[model samples]
Target: MLVLTRRRGQAICIGDNIRIVVTRIEDGQVRLGIESSDNVTILREELLETVKQANQSALSSAPEAFNHWLNQQPKAVDDAGNTKDKA
Candidate 1:
């Protein structure tokens, strides 16, 4: 990580389009203002981590969920496209 000391109102530039500026500092918390193109995505680290964990959990349980759904579905067709008796 490239660490730099920047005071309030100081700004940092990334590449040619992104800029981060320190907006406020109080109570040991720092607030920043970020400028970027409309296509760029900006997310907090914790929010990104939460999304990753939720996605992983969903993927891990997908097979079981699919199986449960399949079992609940009506078994109306056979492998050869023949309709099976409902009884």
Candidate 2:
């Protein structure tokens, strides 16, 4: 990681189309303003991690959920694809 020190109102440029400006610094917090092309996707690290964890959890439980659903379904057909009578 490249680290640089910049006071408020200073800016940093990345590549040709990205710019990050130090907009505010107060109460030990530094705020940045980023300018980028419309096609670029910017996301916070914590939110991205949360989404990944949720997706992993859902995937882990999918097979159990599917089995529960399959058990609840009506046995309307046999292995040969013939309809089975409930009676």
Maximum-lDDT candidate: 1
- Cα deviation at 50, candidate 2, in Å, is 1.4
Writing each residue's lDDT as its tens digit, candidate 1 over 1-87 gives 999999999999999999999999999999999999999989999999999999999999999998888777786888899976554
> Which lDDT tens digits does candidate 2 get at residues 60-81?
9999998888777776887889
Error of 1 at 73 (Å): 4.9
* Model 2, residue 45: C-alpha shift (Å): 1.4
TM-score of each: 0.67, 0.61
